[model samples]
Target: EGDFVIMGTDGLFDNLGEDAIAARILQAYNMMRIDGKVARAVCSWASQALLNDAFNTSLSKTAITPFSIAASEELDLAYSGGKMDDISVLVGMVEHQVQA
Candidate 1:
């Protein structure tokens, strides 16, 4: 019975305002509903949107910055250095039931 789903980046939860995230979610929901796509597809789209937004607004251009290919290394270093901020998520929904 569900119409839409959401997949989001950690940045949206950590840095962006809730109102903004809500608005985006609503927008994505409407889009998915209109297109008749499944919740998992919608979620994938939404997650990419969140990451794209973050990449666009990031201030650091260093090749080894946290948002770059070095993200994994940076995360490891942060863990060792006692920086405990970690965020990763995935969301999906089933739009129809399958018959056995």
Candidate 2:
């Protein structure tokens, strides 16, 4: 069993295939696990990275834009909107059993 995680930009998710989002999330989870990170942490990291990237990247022609604040607000709104769009997440766990 593997964790299926989905991380997406709102633009793509709002306009395109939902299944593609699911597939990409699962793919990301798998890749993260392969890279030696746990599912939950991976998800958190992904979200943080996405937010950071979005904040650093400009979204409009305005030269003085608060990208990070805007991105944070957008994410909050999306979660509240209940539109069921693709969001970033991590899945699964790895256990190293120890002898009792």
Candidate 3:
């Protein structure tokens, strides 16, 4: 399978960590496999999963998110959960061209 890339704004990171992001992408990939969707479709499904997770996490008051942990560790702040923000997610894979 070809490799895929995931890109997002700070808002995305503010709620989800690398582990969470990877999990969502993996879920989407597996789902595509079951649905008969090509690998390229994985990116589209993954992006939606990521966006939904981040947006939901941002609204939580008790969730320990990446940003909250960073704030506590780096700034000694008492942040406990993700802040509501404008989340953006992009997922894609490079396609190879074959010459006849």
For lDDT, the strongest prediction is 3
lDDT of each: 0.51, 0.44, 0.86
lDDT (tens digit, per residue) of candidate 3 on 49-93: 899999999999989998899889999878897879899999987
Model 2, residue 16: C-alpha shift (Å): 13
The lDDT-based order of candidates, best leading, equals 3, 1, 2
Candidate 3 positional error at 11, Å: 0.6
Return the lDDT, model 3, position 73. 93
TM-score per candidate, in order? 0.50, 0.33, 0.87
- Model 2: per-residue lDDT, tens digit, 5-40? 444466333332444334545655776758876667
Backbone clash count, each prediction separately? 0, 3, 0
lDDT of 1: 0.51
- Over 15-66, each residue of candidate 1 has an lDDT whose tens digit, in order, gives 3345555566676788787998666677777766655544443433432323
Better model by lDDT: candidate 1 vs candidate 2: 1
Q: Candidate 2 — worst ten consecutive residues by lDDT sum?
A: 78-87
Arrange candidates by TM-score, descending. Answer: 3, 1, 2
Q: Which clashing pairs does model 2 show?
A: 5-25, 6-25, 43-90
